[model samples]
Target: MDDIYIILVASLFSISCGLLGSFLILRRMAMVGDAISHAVLPGIVIAFLISGSRDSFEMIIGAALLGLITSFLIEFFHKKANLQTDAAIGVTFTWLFALGIILISVFAGQVDLDQECVLYGEIAYVPLDLWITDAGLNMGPKALYVSAFILAAVIIFLSFGYRYLHITTFDSAFAASIGISIGLWHYLLMGMVSMTTVAAFDSVGAILVVALFVVPAATSYLLTRKLKSMLLMTVLLSFLNSFLGYYLASTINGSISGAIASTSGVFFLLAFLFSPIDGIWIKAIKRNFDKSKNTSKTKFNKIFKE
Candidate 1:
């Protein structure tokens, strides 16, 4: 696959993950995405057993369903067992992840499962795969094409349900009072998240999907108060980070997903230090400048009185 195609696919996948993750972060459910990402492993294993192949479509469906199950289990423990939400998520994910590991270990030589491959995903070979055939161009890296479609699907859904999604993102209680069906929205959001993360698993790996999901969106939220502005900025930042990070990784012989995550980390750090509204340096500088102005005003008044 062409290098440009790789960049395009990475951008599409990263942006899709980031957009869905914005809501997760707003609802304080960012870690839920992480939990679902890891817990889906057992689902993948089961899917392999039942389907007899690691088909992308089957894996996606299986992972999404398992993600919903993870959500239900978390809710169950939180509501019925009176467990803390974070603790519930942590427990559920690790146990499932461990079960997946055990399954792989037990059937090591018998099946097509690798623990590192499962955890890290396979982004490097995305360009070599052919998803589209019979065009003037090879239309390389079918993963990019598929991911772009996924991103478009998310955008369309969000567009059509903008008002309801907005209300739910800001305040679920208020959304429910207004007949928005917060429960439905919650499932819908999780479903999209599940799809995006699973799609990303082919290229960016599981760990970086978590990074891509949260960091760009969090940075955008910190940089802008308006949701629209945040969304636009997040998309742009995600694209740029994917392209530049991939180029850097290729040039330096480093992990592409890790490079992208580190690049996003740098972006978050920039937002933390430079965002005008809530940035640490911005606040500190404004405080010192305000103090200086007040001191100058007081000195001027004293001089006039003298």
Candidate 2:
């Protein structure tokens, strides 16, 4: 029963992150997900300081706001200051993460937070934090509720705004020519990424959050070129990772989040080797076959001339 609840909570986290991650991967802004995951740390610390309570809505809101700020700063450096996108992302996330660490070090005894939990995560504790109603009804883990809501919200946004996102991602100039708000869609996607990043931080931590956001989506991206297929594959792969990873963690006596992240990587590796178009092994086999064909042609010409 304990493992069941953990897997269920993990499913919500994986699905929500995987859904938004597909778009991030599509726009080639996957690194931005990394930026937001790390940048939200300072906001979370500040929120805890001001609210004086670790468990409250304010902390999540604060973390989300910082995520948006991180996105904005990256854009500012990239567009206005002429810095490359990767450079901007690297600068923003490292600065914010360092500030968070300093705050944690100074206020170590004051707050209930620890850098270990912030970096590596303590998802095993998630099931211990249950949400019981006033009437004494068992409502399951609080993390499950938050993650499920975010997942539903992401699905709704993608469903209603698919056309706009599709156009903007593939061809921004065409979207602009048709008077579509490219910037609006861009920020909307970032907003979704920010919310999902903050939500997953508790369960997977900032470091492993990148795996949830990129690995499944990237594996799917390699499997198919169509957006719909990629989205479906991402969701399917997320579920697979969550279930299989849970058992793997139990067998190895390891961190559940870490095991899940590793499992996602394994899936990506399989796709990399077996995917029809861009797979490494597939290309190697094709090259060998082509070389054999060329050799046969050369031999046939020599024999005919003789």
- Quote the positional error of residue 192 for candidate 1 in Å: 1.0
Pick by lDDT: which candidate is best? 2
Q: How accurate is candidate 2 locally (lDDT)?
A: 0.89
Screening candidate 2 with a backbone cut-off below 3 angstroms (N, C-alpha, C), the clashing residue pairs are none
Worst 10 residues of 2 by lDDT: 52-61
lDDT of each residue in 1-306, candidate 1, tens digit only: 367777788899988988888888988999999998888888777777777765467877888898898898999999999999999999999998898888878777655878767767667777787756666566566786788789998899789877888898887788888788988888888888887777787687667799998999999999999988888998999998998889888989988888888899998999999999989999999999999999999999999977
> Candidate 2, residues 77-148: lDDT per residue as tens digits?
999999999999999999999999999888887767888888868789888999999999998888888878
- Model 1: weakest 10-residue lDDT segment is 131-140
Query: How far out, in Å, is residue 151 in model 1?
Result: 1.1
Reference-based lDDT, residue 282, model 1: 96
